[model samples]
Target: MKEKDGISECPEQQVILYVEKEDGKYEAMQTGSYISANYLDDYFLKRGTLEKALGEKIARGEINAIEYYMILEDLTISELAARAGIMKWTVRRHLKPGNFSNISESALKKYSIVFNITVKEIVTRQSGNRN
Candidate 1:
């Protein structure tokens, strides 16, 4: 089946599945192309007890994608700074939207420590306009 955006979902028996996003929303093209509730239950059971997780982090009265990336991975500015070998302010500047640029190694390291995630997961080249 095709979704409004013409995206199709190809369901598989794998426990972990990938969902496509269109215009910032999830779209399913056809039934059975997506996993059913029962499938999720069985997948979660096979893995372990699931914990509540947020899609992103809220900060400064705004939902910044960088903030969400850091929070979801459990990273902090100070820690990331140390890892990048740069000042915290530098890290902040890079994290801000529209400031698409490379981050220092020290910052990447700190992010890894705080979020318990990998450097590859934290850093992303901005897409489209900087802001």
Candidate 2:
């Protein structure tokens, strides 16, 4: 992006951007994130809707904490399995409400680590504790 075209809609949230400067040189510039500035509200709106739907599913016992955290983290089964060092099939099993009970404590710890959450949070599904 050109230096003059750099979006500064959010002064509090500055990001380093490589912008085209005058005299035809590229230079590092401080600017607000284009997507964040332009689309943050829409992102939040969609996120709220998803959260509400997921919360309803959780309340209905159609899914478990494992699945809740997984969806909220935007992780695929294979990606979560890789991060937690668990088998993909096992991760899939844990995503089910009934099958989550069969998971071992060590496995739960692995998932908690992957989610950056406490094991208790994984057990309870009380989310929004990202560090």
Write the residue-wise lDDT of candidate 1 on 1-131 in tens digits.
11343332445432332345555655543333235423666767644432112221222223334455555445687766665566788778876654533655665566566656666554531221112
Runs in model 2 with CA error above 4 Å?
126-131
Per-residue lDDT of 26-121 in model 2, one digit per residue for the tens? 999888887888888998999899877877777777877788878988999999999999989888888877776688999999999998988987
C-alpha TM-score for every candidate: 0.34, 0.81
Q: Give the range of the ten consecutive residues with the poorest summed lDDT in model 2.
A: 122-131
lDDT of 2 at 44: 90
TM-score of 1: 0.34
